[model samples]
Target: MTGTILTEDAGDGVRIVTLNRPHRLNAIVPELLDDLNHALEAADRDPAIRAIVLTGAGRAFCSGDDLKDFGTQAADEPGTRAYIERIQDVTRNLVLGDTPIIGAIRGWAVGGGLEWVINCDFAIAAEGTRFFFPEIAWGVFVTGGVSELLPRLVGLQRARELIMLGERFDAAQAREWGLVYKVVPDATLRDEALNLARRIAALPVGPVRDLRRILARRDALAPAMAAETDATVRGFLDPATAARIGAFK
Candidate 1:
């Protein structure tokens, strides 16, 4: 593990993968996305790794796309498409890979960050963590198959409200909406996630693998991903959206 992604062996066949850009709140840059995708793929192929605890270093799990960095990529169609594809690659690894991932979330999990939270096999959020999707307001679409997954998790009406309104919700609301598996104290979030991963590692590997495969067998996922990529790439290239992103920078 190198660059924006860090890996640690926690013994018992469990590996801890941390998004290491603490200075920027682990915001999604192209490099971060690339490093994360590679890290996930490596873990998935390693038979010695039974479970993965995915977390971020610093005050936030992820602050979403670094609009400043991402905005520059939007200057051209090819850069825009490649960037969105890299984002989708992370989702593919998390949702389709053989290794089970447990998200240890805290602080802000906004936009794409929140989408990754939803992509986790099951996430454990800290009590005060904040989550939201600002994509609609910014003229971009949600990716990571959130369109399909959110509706299934929180019902269609609630999912619409979340993405359309782009409102911020706390861990309690996330739990009520079935977004997170459990909410733990901020101080104990990492420990709890690792303990859970350890337990998962102790389970029978065959059944665990089967369960992961069964749950992720969503036929709608591929189509949703394709649609999202197209929409998001177009959003990035839109003049109005570029202006909005520029103002933020």
Candidate 2:
């Protein structure tokens, strides 16, 4: 019962999860978030599936939250809080879910969309892909363990600059910053990602899953997720931030 995302089995313990809302550039909404949460967890729990590939359906991987819906959502603080909780739920799975998740990114990966790319176990991006963290500029705060994870990926100074400046950076820079593990030509993005996922899936499941767990900062993730939830709710409800979101609409 997939909704905003399409799921396909790639065989040999690999599953491809596609974000389906091409018209909206697969922007984040409660439905999409919930779908991702359910889909990702299901893949992780399926014993035959060893790896998951997450990609977007159209031009952009994701353009972040659907600002059109955000303006109305922020008007109701409880609605805003619940929406972010769903977003964090997806993030939680990305961070702790057993199946290795690889992100195949192309086009715009902005705001919360960029957070997904960051949290993915190993991200492969098209050369033309662009990413940015727009929370600061939008008068909102970071979520998805972004504050801790970004710094771990790109150093505290660089993460601070990227978060505070909210400027767009290309795939090459992202690769150099260690946020992305690989960068391929636009025409081959999906193929390359699929190949990588298949290769990872071919490895012995126990060792692979164990290695992932051993590498993960399990102790850090929970606190970071909790902090993100609190900050996300606070930012969404802040009058000034709501005003900014309102003005954008």
Candidate 3:
């Protein structure tokens, strides 16, 4: 399935789903977000598809939300809150879904994009991949359970540096933080990620799926995500956030 995003069976129960907006660095627009959720849900529903490899088309895995289109979104607080919920649902699906997902991160993974990396079951990044959590820099709070989940991965201090201070980190640093499972040659990111996904898909689904579910800890994530979403809605409506966004524009 190919539309705003791309999805194709990569054989042996491994599906390859690419974020297809290369011209825009695969930024999250309404179309891309909706398509991504539909693709992930469809893959999970298909019994034949046991695992998924998510990557980008050209450079970035996803830069972030497309700020270019932000001005056109519904201006009211209620309308904006609903849109935020839709974005959070993508992360919810990724966290709770039975099928495991492998992220093939290449270039920039910043802002909302970095949230995906934190939520993926496994992430294989290219040596050249650059990561940053600049939501604070852009005057917005993170929608995903990044506040709660990120600290669990990299300790509270570093999570604050990354998300609160808005620092940029390299793949080597990301590997040290345990966010990336493997850092390979930049040229082979796709092949390496696909190979891992194929290996995962070849394993028996029952134990593999069960292990993933236990690790996901959806019971905790559900409420943490809800809290984050509610906080994000408030940030989205803040006059300071609006001023910063206007300046960015």
Best by lDDT: 1
User: Residue 157 deviation, candidate 2, in Å?
Assistant: 0.1
TM-score of each: 0.97, 0.95, 0.96
Those runs of model 3 whose alpha carbons end farther than 4 Å from true positions after fitting are none
Tell how far residue 33 is off in model 2, in angstroms: 0.7
TM-score computed on alpha carbons, candidate 3? 0.96
Off by over 4 Å in 2: none
Error of 1 at 239 (Å): 0.4
Across 84-142, the per-residue lDDT of candidate 2 in tens digits comes to: 88888888788778899999999999988999998898999999999998888877877
lDDT of 2 at 191: 88
lDDT of 2 at 198: 92
Candidate 2, residue 244: Cα displacement in angstroms equals: 1.6
> 1-249 in candidate 3: lDDT tens per residue?
348788889898999989999999988888888898999999999999998998888988989888887665436678778888888988877878889889999899988788988888899999999999767776677867787789889999998898888888999999999999999998888889888999999999999989988887778888888888777777777778777878987
RMSD of 2: 1.4
Tell me how far the alpha carbon of residue 3 in candidate 1 is from the true structure, in angstroms, after superposition: 1.8
> Arrange candidates by TM-score, highest first: which order?
1, 3, 2
